[model samples]
Target: MNRRLLGAVAAVVALVLGVGALFLLLPERGQGPAAAPASTTSAPATPTSTTTAPRVLVDGPVGVPTRIEIAELGVDAPVMAVGTTPENAQEVPSSLDATGWWRDGAEPGAPGNAVIVGHTASVDDAVFDPLVDAEVGDEVFVTGSGGTVAFTVERTETVPVADFGDVAADVYRSEGDSGLVLMTCGDWNGNSFESTVIVHAVPTGA
Candidate 1:
């Protein structure tokens, strides 16, 4: 073929290839065609209530106490972790000290009954807040390093500060089980006492 003719054919082929490449890379902007979506794109997954595990959980060491969280009222706070010692007892929240129930008992989610004590007075209004709203069968979720432990509210009552044993029925109810008990001044609403709110829960279903 002649040189001019060969060059013209080569130019036509180059132009076609260039146009095809542009279409593959760039989408038309103004009054052009809509860009096709990527076929490999995926949508986000939604959360579901159906879970394999139980709804309530307890967290922390087997014997070392930590924080307590109640989902019903968004009550997540750093609980004063105390065993049965003068120093450790002093560390207990003043509002929670009236009750002798200390860490000498069980740690959260442990084998035995884990007892936590708090106060109901408002000198600082620092504990047992909104205690009047608690109800039976309410689930209390405790959390720590171990995991979350679940408990049901067995009962709540008011008693005199002198009446401590009344709660023993609720606190030391059963044996050989994991449980949690929360006590606040409910005996007599005086200098350091008020309605004692006690929460009892155990491994009922699982």
Candidate 2:
């Protein structure tokens, strides 16, 4: 994936210099959490349409995402602001219990994609272990210092890591109706994985 976004690159540099937390602009092979093989199962592909039912909008201050919850998946984890690493790739949280929110991008409930990433397998509990089982129409919620935003799953896709260029538009889309994306590495077995699991959802209500 290209680290062409100027804002993301700048944030990553700042994060590394000040906080000392490493952030990568792209997925560095052999540097992330342990990879696990994805179970074989027939799953639906990405939705062709972005159409969605009109959702109630919140007319107030929007806060930075602080946490994310997926009730069906038993996920209720902290959200930390993350930028790119010195290598110019997306940043991953140091702890598996936390999910990294792309700080340089849109916030939840805003007119763009708000991204959150996590690990599929961790030393403790797998944070996104159940992400592959996520189904369209499932519920997801994000809370920040500003407020809470609700969303409903619209699609799930597993894309080969090398083919990320094909879906770069959707992943880096910064203009559109409010949306949320959850991502984690998958199909990996200790060394390498073929793809990543991306859960796409849209804001439904406050």
Candidate 3:
């Protein structure tokens, strides 16, 4: 595929797998987070009655994400907006301590999927290393200039690089309720990551 098309696909796939060539150069630390044990099905589970709280709605205009926090994982990091690179790859944060939010995608607590990508590991500890320990029902809080939106971990999936294009379509879909997608490289195989780990979340009133 052409670079532009590939980049677009990368953005979508990154929503789930945080695919990036740079990550390959970094030394391996440990295995990527295993898929949340609760996620057994291939498809994302629809939010059911278990979510008793009303979905948090944007009070006014959606704000750009400024920070992301996962109490369960003890993650508290700054966020920067980023787009695709000239090579047609999704742009990632330069610092391992921060994360990059897809500028063209939905803002948190808005109408569509908001994607955040971070490195799984770097020479020093990376921002998202703790993601490998994430589980369903974990809470992800995204702070914006406007306000904060809370999301509940819905599912996690690990897919091969070759198959990410198909999965990307679903991750980037905009028809559903406001959602969050976290992506990171998964399963290092010496030269490159054999797969990508994707975490799906939905806004919860809390």
Candidate 4:
């Protein structure tokens, strides 16, 4: 996220000064309460579309670095997943910047939305940040233990945080297209309930 777009959050945490949270810029995730892996060692991220298990976040569990390849922006970075509730959303760095779309609801290629998040403001947006340029017909892929799930970029838009809270049908819903929202700084002003940058995409194939 550009400093100007980051707004107050950016003001408080500036990458310009190189004092911002590096973890914050690392793409993150947010899902409903669910038991998952406790914790694990982190490995380096590569360009290989290898599907691997994710590291666990045990109580502020560090989000595993799941690589994201955006063919359009040429972005490649590891996106982190976090729990959606207030208790965990901010706790996960990956989720804080560009949190996960939430998996329990729908499998990437199954149906519903397959969301993911990451910081758009990075020294070099190798991953989640590139979503800013993602437009309809673009592609976003995530490699996890299950496998590689690719999503076609539907469109990008900002919505009230409250509305994004449990997406319904019309508000934050998309059936004609797979529902994948890569949310980020939208208001670039408010600290809360600003706006959400939604990069709509669907699973292309494995």
Q: Relative to the true structure, how large is the alpha-carbon lDDT of every model?
A: 0.42, 0.61, 0.62, 0.40
lDDT of the structure predicted as candidate 2: 0.61
Q: Can you write out model 2's per-residue Cα lDDT over 105-158, one digit (the tens) per residue?
A: 788888778888776662335567788899988998777665677889999998
Q: What is the lDDT, from 0 to 100, of the residue 9 in candidate 1?
A: 9
TM-scores of all predicted structures: 0.56, 0.71, 0.71, 0.51
Tens digits of per-residue lDDT, candidate 4, 173-206, equal 3234444556553443422224455666655542
True-structure lDDT of candidate 3:
0.62
lDDT of 4 at 100: 41
Q: How accurate is candidate 1 locally (lDDT)?
A: 0.42
User: Which model scores highest in lDDT?
Assistant: 3
The digit string of per-residue lDDT tens for model 3 on 89-195 reads 45567666777787766888877788887877523467887776789999988877666788899999887765675576567665567889998767765444566
RMSD of every prediction: 30.8, 11.5, 12.2, 11.8
| Reference-based TM-score, model 1 | 0.56
lDDT at position 111, candidate 2: 75
- The per-residue C-alpha lDDT of model 4 at residue 10 equals 13
